[model samples]
Target: MIELKHVNKYYRNDEEELHVLKDINMSVEAGEMIAVMGPSGSGKSTLINTLGFIDTKFDGEYLFEGENLVTSSDDRLSKVRNQIVGFVFQNFSLIENNTVYENVELPLLYNGYGFHETKERVMDALVKVGIADKADKHPKQLSGGQQQRVAIARALINQPSFIIADEPTGALDTHTSTEIMELFRELNRKESATIFLVTHDPEVVPYCDRLISIRDGAIIEDRAVIHE
Candidate 1:
């Protein structure tokens, strides 16, 4: 579903050019949960930005479903980004003023769905994430786990080609984190949701089907995760 070839990213400061991503190449199949593990200053965020279509200032090929987007126009990239990728962040990124229902509905509305047309789609997503009961509540009224569930629901509402989760379980306690990871594992198992999980937590790696380790702006290991 996704491929990156000979990808390299550079940053400029003062009179120096620093290379960040180094010869990054990766391919993702459908319905796979991949854990991207890296520490600080390892170019992990840059890679995620590249894959999620938020960064196009790198040298190389980024092919999503066979179309190369390296040279696409900003408008074209925006369209593709909205239509193909769903992003979940550590902060949940929910609107505190909006009800859970409204928060999840925003994406559909942006995609051209009328308000009346969003109820079913919104409710279904909420239900899938085990948060249908919280639809009427605001973000501040919910616990961290519930809030993340809403975020996951919002991400799923689009049925995009994949979901990019960056530090998805970062804000919760260990128990809540486990619950969220289990939720993700179940989603991947039952609904075939393709997900790219960006986390520095080793505990988060086991829930994913594949493990990708990066350091010094390069992928050092790509392997399947085996539960034992």
Candidate 2:
């Protein structure tokens, strides 16, 4: 459902140009779970932004369902980004003032769902992430794992075609990280949810179906992850 062909990104600084992504060629089918890993200054962030539809100024084509979405209008791209990608960040960007249900309900509201129509969808999302019982709780009252669960629930509430889990397990302890990864795997397997996981931890790679490594502003390796 997604393809990047000979894509390149450049940043201008004075009279010089900085190449961030060079000749990136990738295709992702629906229901695939992929992990991306890279060190600092490796251009992974640039690549992620490009794939997530936030960065459109590039040298090649970004095809979604066979159409070049990168060349679309800014307003169209913004709407498509909202409808096609859900983001889960490392910091668990939840509002401390909002209840779990409220946090999960925000996306539906943005998508034009009325308050009366959101309860079922919000509860289902919470249940999917195993946090339905904590719907009334606040972020400060929950553990880190639980907060992250809420974040994942919020991401899934929109039912976007792609979930961009940017270091989803980064803030948790080892045991909690394992639990969260297992949850993600279960969702991928049962729901056929397409996941694009960005993580630096090698331990997390085993849970993914494929891995792509980036270095020096280029894709150095892309291969399937064999689970044993």
Candidate 3:
């Protein structure tokens, strides 16, 4: 549901232009769990933002679910983003003051869901992420893994077609990371949530159906791998 062809992202700094991504070509289909692995400064996050419609000024074409992203308006892009792409970041970007249920309900609020519908969707998302019992808890009260699950619940509240995760397991220990990866796998396999994850952890690589390596702002390797 995502495609980038010859994509080039540039940043202008006084007298120099920094090229972050160069000639990036990628395609992600439905129900696929793809991991983007690379060293630091390999443009993994940049590519993820571009795919998620969070970044716009690039030199090539990006198509999402058959629509040309470059031609879409800002309003249209926002709509598409809200409806199609769910994002999970390395930091659990939840509001410290809000409860888990409230945090997960933010997206639905923006989508104009009624009170009853919002409660139902938010509760379902929390349950799906296995954190429904913590619905009343705040971010500071939860463990790293639980907080990440709340973030995942927020991401899933919209029932998005795809999820873009940037270092989903970065802030956790190995065991917690394993649990998070397993959750992602189940989401992909059972709920058909297409996931594009950016990670550097080799241990987490085996869980992905596709492994993509990036170096010097380009995709060095993109191949299907055996998943356990």
Candidate 4:
């Protein structure tokens, strides 16, 4: 569902240019759960940002479900992100003042959904994430795992075809992380959402259907695991 051809990303320092991604050619198919593993400064986040259409300043072509995302306009890109992409960050980017319900409903508000539709979508998302009962609680009132679930609920409220998660289990404990990973696996298998996950933990690799390892801005290993 996603393709990147000869993608190159560069940044400028005071006197030197930083090459973040070098000729990165990759493709992700629909209904596939892929884990992206890399060490620090290995361009994992850059790839994620490029795929999410958040960072548009780069070289090469990005195709999303057959559309050339590289040449797409900002308005078009925003629409693609809103309708086709869902993002989950490590820190669980939940609003401090808003309750879980409001946080999940914020995207619907921006998408111009009416009150009734927004309420339905939000409630459905909360239930899907198993956090419907915690809808009225603030972020601080819940545990880290619960907050992450709420964030995932917010992301899923749009019913996007693909999810991009960066360090999804970074802040939670091992047990909580396992729980979150199980939730993600369920979403991938049951909901048929293609997942592009970036994580530094090797322990999370077994949870994914496929694993792609990157080093020095290049993909070194790509394999699909077959479990017994």
Candidate 5:
């Protein structure tokens, strides 16, 4: 569903330019769950941002479902991001004052869905993430796992074709992280949603179908995970 060809990214200051991603080339297929693993400063997150169209200041080609994002206009990129990509951040990125229901409903509202349809979609997403009952609760009232579930629900409400999860389970306990990863596995299996997970945890890597390891802005390893 997505491909990056010889992609490069850099950050520039008045003094010098630092290359953060060097000749990164990768492909992710539909219904595939892949992990991009690397330590801090390794450009894994930059790679994710590039794939999600969250970072557009890069060189080379990024093709999403056949369209070259590098050549696409800002308006087109924005539309694609809203309609095709869903993002989950390590921080949960929830609105503290909004209830879970409202939080999940924001995307639909932004996408111009009617009230009834928005309500239905939000509820369905919450149910899918196993958090339907907590719709009325605020983010602070929920546990870390529950809050992350809310974030996932928000990401899924749009039924996006691609889900970009950056350190999704970074703050959760081990058991909770396993639960979340299992949930992602189910989503990949049953819903056919392509997932690109950016994480540093080796335990989380086992849940993915493929592992792409990066170091110092370069991919050092890319391999499929074998299951017995």
Candidate 6:
């Protein structure tokens, strides 16, 4: 569903230019779950941002469903991001004051969905993530795992073709991390959702269909995972 060819990203600091992504070339198919693994400063986040169109100041062809995003206008990119891609950050990125239901409903509201449809989708997403009962709770009232589930629910409310998750379980305990990974696995297996997850945890790698390792701003490994 997505492809990056000869992609290169750089940052400038006063007098020097630092290359963060060096000639990165990658592709993700529909319904495929991919894990991007790398240590800090390895450009994993940069790669994810590039893939999600969050960082557009780069050189290369970013094709999503056959359209080249590199040439797309800001408005078009925003539209595509809102309609086709869903993002889950390590920080949960939820509003502290908003209830879980409102948090999940924000994206639909931004996308201009009507009240009835928004309500239905928000509820369904919460149910899918197994957090329907906490709809009225605020982010602070929930545990780390529950907050992440809410983030996931918000990401899924759009029924996006691609879900870009960055360190989704970074702050959770091992058991909770496993549960979150299982949730992602279920989404990939049953809903046919394409997921691009960026994580440093090896335990989380096995849940993905493919594992991609990056170092020095370039991909060092890309292979399918064999489930035992």
Candidate 2 residue-wise lDDT, 23-141, digit = tens? 99999999999999999888888999998998889999899899988878898888888888998999999999999999999988888899999999999999999989999999999
lDDT of 5: 0.90
Tens digits of per-residue lDDT, candidate 1, 63-93, equal 8889897578888888788778999999999
Task: Give Cα distance to truth, residue 200, candidate 3, Å.
Answer: 1.0
Q: Report the lDDT tens digits of candidate 5 across residue range 1-228.
A: 788899999999999999999999888889999998999999998888888888998988988888886567998888778888999988899999999999999999888888777877788899899999999999999999999999999899888988999999999998999899999999889898899899999988888899999999999999998876
State which candidate, 4 or 6, has the greater lDDT: 6
**CA RMSD for every model?**
0.9, 0.9, 1.2, 1.2, 1.1, 1.1
Sliding window of 10 residues with minimal summed lDDT for model 5 = 63-72
State the RMSD for candidate 5: 1.1
Error of 2 at 213 (Å): 0.5
Q: Which digits, one per residue and each the tens of the lDDT, describe model 6 over residues 1-228?
A: 788899999999999999999998888889999999999999998898888778899988888888886578999888878878899989999999999999999999888887777877888999999999999999999999999999999999888889999999998899999999999999999899999989999998889999999999999999999999
Candidate 4 runs further than 4 Å off:
none
Task: Point out the higher-scoring one by TM-score: 2 or 6.
Answer: 2
Each model's TM-score, in the order given?
Answer: 0.98, 0.97, 0.96, 0.96, 0.96, 0.97
The runs of at least 3 residues in candidate 5 whose Cα sits more than 4 Å from the true structure, single-residue gaps closed, are none
Computed on alpha carbons, the lDDT of every model, listed in order, comes to 0.93, 0.92, 0.90, 0.90, 0.90, 0.92
Deviation of model 4 at 200, angstroms:
0.5
Show the lowest summed lDDT stretch of 10 residues, model 1.
69-78
Model 4 poorest ten-residue lDDT run: 219-228
Winning candidate number (lDDT): 1
User: Per-residue error at 140 for model 6, in Å?
Assistant: 1.5
